[model samples]
Target: MPLLRMFRVFVCCVLALTAMGVCGQNSLANQTIKWDDYTYKFLSTGQSAQVFDSAGKVVGTILSMNGDLQMIPLPGTDEEKLKKSFADWKAFYARSHSAGGSSSAGATATPAASSSNGGPAVPCPSTYGVSYFDGTAWKTMMLAVQMPKEKSVSLSQGFKDMGKNPLNPRAGETMIYRYKDPAAPLTTGPNPSFCVSISANFNPSQIMIGTVDIKKDHREIEQAVSSRDSWLPPKRVQQVDIKRVSETVVVVTPKTPLPPGQYVLGGPPMVGIYDFGVRASQ
Candidate 1:
């Protein structure tokens, strides 16, 4: 047989095998894992402590953040990664402190606000980018962070329910994202809006989006996280009135500063235009 033909045949077989493994897999609450431009890190204990993105992809690992502090391997990822995540956050806080460690400058600010307001240049400290909906279109701006080598193992095991590990807290910890409002409603008159949703590789665990309503808009546009057990976010809706500049252009400013660390935007989902929609106004 021709060598070229044999190579083609081998490639076909590999593709076929991969498709079979994915096609019949159990549905974990109708969630799909997207592995595009996304990679995870494993911590010292052979678990994943964090996931970073090179492209504008929503690659999230099971982790949390308090202020600028990233909650590394809850109890078990990298004994060092957890300590490092905390250490990095502490150092960041120390630098931003005017007198105390509290930053009055704000952590995550929207480009629109930063450009117009003469404030310190807001950096992309979070893992993911900002997502927006303009009724007719969706827009997202994302930034990916690099994972430390020591935490690679923990980052991997964190997404799986592999019995009990010495590092992670439970089978899977709560995965968090910076959820933005879907510009248009799912239905025209009265229905669930096309809100951004999230999922993880492991079972039982879920993504949560928490929102807070800063403006007295009858619609409570707050930052929130979504999980099977509950949906949460550290802050409430700070702003509303997401501007749909064009069909695919949606711009919003978060009402409050975003928590430090990595995050992702879920969607610029399909929806209609109207003043009733919501946006994450930082």
Candidate 2:
């Protein structure tokens, strides 16, 4: 349901901004780099699109990009706040395009709200951010990093309150972080696609997706980070077909249909790592 709501917001932003027009252009951007520094710092080049403010609100949305991201409703949050953000963005959008237009951006007709799989139609997702079509609609994937201990690092599903680690984390874990689901899931499609909103220094071709080594008990997934450069980078193993889309939105597809097994995806998921089990062919 969150995925559906999130998808709507993403589409709404793109439709509004695209209708208005682009503000600036980067000399080198491929795949999915929707927002740039001309928009906001946290949403700028090489920055994570999942940016949040001190208030724990998501801040990298088109509605709030040119102005203050903190002013907009989080991707799937308050409708009124989102409405206000649309009103506000019209001003910025006009400045960016140097054209005259109303706040139709905010007036986006949000499709039917969150529904049971059998409910109203969900909006198709844009080619922005990191996500894949999971049979129904485009479902966004969670970015998982790791919480390294001395030798090993642990991963969790939807681990919230990012900075507050369990008393242990060996009491020595790095606090630079963000939220992520314990599992970067794939309900269908063996050759899944991913949108990498890469940064300035990041090479679009360096898309990282890997087969996770699942343990017998399978309670959770963690690996030794003793040999990592910086707490590991998604344990990449599979080579992918990385293609640059519109701007910096890189789409990463498996070179071949993957067989059923556990896997992971994240090249710069700077916090906790997660895994998935691909039993679709089962």
Candidate 3:
């Protein structure tokens, strides 16, 4: 009888151990694992997973098989890096503008004062020329003063007549033009009129103008420029208004100017596009 009791006790111990082992395996199967700079949320054991950044943005996707983790990084996953790039550009523009030096046309400024009374002066040449309606006046915002090379050829004599002929044609680069009124309050509803002039001729159907999510990275901008896909999943746009101003100029006027954020204006494959920003005045 003592031997029989001993056998029964041993059997009970084995069952308890088996139950514990099963529980432990279940717990591990449901566990989220952290690897390198990403946290992996397991959708299936040894199958599929999602990787996320600290901000909970899906930075990558993971496939686990045979105890191996294969990670695929999503384009524009580096949000912080993109933000820093924007900040650096803004700082450089600020420094150059304050110093009254020639800089990229990405920065926005009011017309320089020609007189003490702040009367209108000759519009500055901007890489991407822009015109906007400021509720009361149709003001031209000139970020630079040099006419583009293509435009210069046609206006050489006209420029000479003004006595301030452009010495050299300014080779234009891809740029973003911004317009903001310091006195205007932050607005969510469409109110301000904003327009941009592109230097290329493109089909109106192929042209897309949309607001960009500053949180996204440069890859998102590239995608938007390519026009292959809408950047940031759902395209952020208030409304798109594009018109053919001339054979060489395609004007884009957003129904309402983006409040204060990054935006993109481009054609399919992003042949010629501008990525610009709007900052609210302090």
Candidate 4:
């Protein structure tokens, strides 16, 4: 009789464990994850939070969390639940991005960002840097600096030179640069394969690239502004076209084919810009 009682107790314990496996008693919000000396918890529902505009104003929404992802665990874990959560976030990210939702996060509080300002905001290797694909590899382009003027202006071979940056070029004597060679050290074929990457955290929208202002002997990039001042030169700023090729990275190209000349990528006086020359392929 005692042996029979022992066997029954064992069977009951197994049944209880099986029941727990089928039921999700633990969820991300209720669980605590301890790794090393740090304690972490699931803080987001894996949905879009708040979106921001150029000036950082609230916008719209994306996907909503449908179920708990276990947040992480195995042994009869809710694998289906986890998959659904990921799918929801992925679809939501696409819709939110198209709507210009800058603060959208797919799985947690991580932001898939974008820029509305008139400059390259992210994912250019550096904050204010650019690169070009040489059919072999992507190479870093150098930043071009004008002699340091104050206001925006235009200069050409002899075309009525528009206003020029009036600020002091530097603490040293104001000077003009003359170049026997192309101002940009790197040169690309007229139809270069350069692109902008819009991976998560890389905002490719607020970017600005322009045709380098060619003078008698020097090149300047002062006309890549949104102002489009009648006093400034025309066709200096080139609009960018964005196309997403994957989950995190989008390729950006000049909407128009570049003509043979110098081009600048980047903006905002304080941040500076990257430059390269485009020439006929030999």
Candidate 5:
């Protein structure tokens, strides 16, 4: 009988261990979707924004002006999630491209094809610090800073210009657009332009401007204010130059020689109207 009891105890122990392992795996899965720590505030409303993060670290800040403000961080364990998200994004993109997915019949999702100058034929979306304000409601859009191809000239040049480490340019990076003229209006139209942010994580070692879809053209309306000389020469003044800061925000410097008689009376926003910063969604 004693021997039988010992065997039963062994079975129970095995079951307990198995249960623990299952629980552990589940905990890990939840952690996989977790993000870093961060915060955001609405300067105009003077209200504190409600931030969210699964990993206990704030990966994004919710602001009143923008819908959801997000910054890119070092891949860490989130690399898998990032990869998965990217894959899902690409798949959705493909489906949308083939005219397979859309609310309207005969609708088409066209890919954004840039000209030889590497600029979009149509205006780019506000993927750098995009904000949405609805009467009394406000939200910042979330986005991901997609790094440029390692071997590409754009990535190399971006690294050189921004003083970012080419080896790990996407780690713990965040960008804030500080407008030179707080009251100036952000450009909105085909190829809308603005300035680069002077806050931390605005520039990393390497960067690349990703291909933005032209279907949702409204993204070109978000904007932030900033100086023109922080990242490029004054001669390149106000010429909106898009540079990837990681996977969350793409920095832009507006074109110079403003509208004939138009002079740059004030500093531009690091993220101007329609600038959509990068972030990921669960």
Candidate 6:
């Protein structure tokens, strides 16, 4: 009878342990949500945080209270698709705000400014200190800087150029560049042009612009970006025309038009590499 009782107790303990293990696994799975190539972990505060791929690594704080999660695209994400996503989110946000419903956690129900082109005017996050080129002049917008605790060395040269400006007296700590109209039609030219405002301290000779060889596999690209040792190699190092618009502003244009692929604009020692894409004109 004693032996039987002991065996029964052991069985109960085993069952309890098994149940606990399943519960723990469920909890872990519930805590993480994988969206595309990125895995986002829910914080204790219920906020979903995403880090930007730039020099001053900005964190996008998303409120997930109402189960409606709106987010900015991760760096190296297809820019063309992101524009559509942004538009959809903006519309949803606007409707929610109009209905007096909470659109995002901690976000007030304020209507976003309407754009001249009949699209929702999405304000850029001020945390990254960004400006945009409006065809004629560079206009500053959403100038806020939130520096990360651990300084990242992987910010692209283009990001660095946009963030660290000396001329703008009212500029924030870190600078970023945004498109005036994200949904603007892609430039259908022989070569697409990218412009950057160079700081006085930056050495023009160290700036290197080349096409990046992105892997066909999304997992491979994510792994390459995450690993410090996995610096993706650049192909066809061509000389680009570095036209100086001002003492502080310079435009780097490739001599030949880039084929439809991913590219990087930065220099050797490979610390501040930036990523851009060339999509087929639609």
Q: Go through the candidates in order and give each one's C-alpha lDDT.
A: 0.31, 0.42, 0.42, 0.44, 0.31, 0.40
TM-score of each: 0.18, 0.39, 0.27, 0.43, 0.18, 0.29
Winner on TM-score between 2 and 6 is: 2
Where model 4 places Cα greater than 4 Å from the true spot, the runs are 1-44, 47-128, 148-183, 191-206, 221-234, 242-252
Worst 10 residues of 2 by lDDT: 107-116
lDDT of 2 at 39: 27
After superposing all C-alphas onto the true structure, candidate 5 shows an RMSD in angstroms of 20.8
Residue-wise lDDT of candidate 1 within 108-210, one digit each (tens)?
A: 2112212111222223222233433333433342322212212112344445544444554454443322123422222121111122222222211122223
lDDT of 3 by residue, 245-273 (tens): 22233334555545766554455343344
lDDT of 6 at 268: 32
Task: Please report how far candidate 5 places residue 168 from its true position, in Å.
Answer: 38
lDDT string, candidate 6, 126-204, tens digits:
2222233344333343311112222223335334444666453433232222222222222222354444434444544
User: Which residue runs does candidate 3 get wrong by more than 4 Å?
Assistant: 1-201, 215-234
Worst 10 residues of 5 by lDDT: 217-226
lDDT top scorer: 4
Better of 4 and 5 by lDDT: 4
Give per-model CA RMSD: 24.1, 18.7, 22.0, 13.2, 20.8, 21.8
| Per-residue lDDT of candidate 2, residues 1-282 (tens digit) | 999999999999988876443332221112132221112222343212343433445554442344332333355665564444334333334443343422222112222112112221333244335665465565666544444323322344113213454443333222223223433444445656554555444555445666654444232334332223533334436766654332344445677777776676666542123344566663
Higher-ranked by TM-score: 3 or 6: 6
- Give candidate 5's error at residue 245 in angstroms: 17
Q: Which sections of candidate 2 miss by over 4 Å?
A: 1-129, 145-186, 216-236, 269-274, 280-282
**How many residue-pair clashes does candidate 5 contain?**
73
lDDT of 2 at 112: 18
- Backbone clash count for every predicted candidate, in the order shown: 58, 18, 4, 9, 73, 7
Q: How would you order the candidates by lDDT, starting with the best? A: 4, 2, 3, 6, 5, 1
Off by over 4 Å in 1: 1-241, 256-264, 268-282
Best by TM-score: 4
